[model samples]
Target: MKLSDFKEGALGGVPIALGYLSVSFAYGIMAAGGGIDPLSAVLISMTNLTSAGQLAGTQLIIDGATYFQIAVTTLVINLRYMLMSLSLSQRIDPKMSTGERLLVSYGITDEIFAVAYQREKAPNTPYMLGLISLPYVGWTLGTLLGATAGNILPERLCSALGIAIYGMFVAIVIPQCRKSHPCLVVVAVAAALSCLLKYVPVLSSVPTGWAIIICTVAASVLGAVLYPEEVDEV
Candidate 1:
């Protein structure tokens, strides 16, 4: 929890914060397009650090989905965070108090988790806090800007900006896909499943929430089965 450690962590988070800003801008635009007010959209980004969950939830809200439907859909989409949290529990400094751990857990997004996990030693409270701080601000600020822009900008411009989110996703996935066959296979399977759900007659009727769940589970299982890891010899 030293000042130096905290500063270093913040430095490490700069790139991630920049990335979040771009992605969350798209989220804000989408939320506004779905009829959510700027303030409410900003609040959503502040509270929920999840891109997919927030976008899906916003769509459900626009569609007039029931409370149960929204709850289940969000839960299913965010189920991976539970596993991420569990993995992170083992990496945080042992001296981190229960309260600090609880606070840090609030900011455990995929990017944050990856950065925290890469440290040579366990991350302490101040480091974790610093790491999460800028990205949190960037995400919220971007959402605010995008939401406001959605109100002021012409419909055509907003529509164009909407594609930024998908572009960001591709930028994230392509490098990993290039390096790992398993990642490539999984991405392909997931994309195919998504397209099928969108185009197939009977399957096209399936809800968006359910389609995501099915694609994620199916792709993960297939990857694990096809690319079982090799054990190292002692």
Candidate 2:
């Protein structure tokens, strides 16, 4: 919780914040275009900090879905965060208080979790707080700007910016895939399953969020069974 640790974490988080801006920008556009107000879109980013979940939820809302549908869709899409939090628990200080753990849990986005896991040692409270701070702000601010400007921006530009989010995941995964056989195999299997679920007539009826959850669990279990000794590298 030292000032130095917090500053170091904030510095480390700069790249993450920059990356989030692009993705959240796209989310904002989607939300506003779908009829949500700019302020509500910003609030969604502030509260959720989940790109996929927010996107899915907004789409459901646009479709005039029931509250239950929105909840289930988001829960399905974000179910991986529960697993990430469980895995991160092993690395965080066991003595960290319950309140601090709750705070940390609130900030556990995919990129933040990956960055924290890559650290040589578990980060302390202030460090973890600082790590999540700017990205949170960037996500919210991007949503604000995008929502307010969605109508002004060309549809082509908005669509292009939407692809930026996928690029961030690629950046996170490519190095690990290259360095570790397990990572490569897991990613390949997940990709294959995703394609199969989308293209195979029998499975194509599955909801996108549910398909993602299934693919993730299947890939993760396979990796764990095949390489029980290999610690995650990224």
For model 1, how does the per-residue alpha-carbon lDDT over 75-192 read when each residue is reduced to its tens digit? 8778878877888888889888899988999998878888998898789988888899999999999999898876688778788889888887788689888878788999999999
**What lDDT is obtained when candidate 2 is compared to the true structure?**
0.84
lDDT of 2 by residue, 96-206 (tens): 899999888999988889888778867778889889999999998889988998668887998888667677678868988888889899999999999999999999987
- Cα RMSD of predicted structure 2: 3.3
TM-scores for the candidates: 0.89, 0.78
The collision pairs in model 2 are none
Off by over 4 Å in 2: 63-80, 93-95, 117-122, 200-202, 221-234
- Model 1: runs farther than 4 Å from truth? 154-156, 230-234
Q: Which ten residues in a row have the lowest lDDT in candidate 2?
A: 225-234
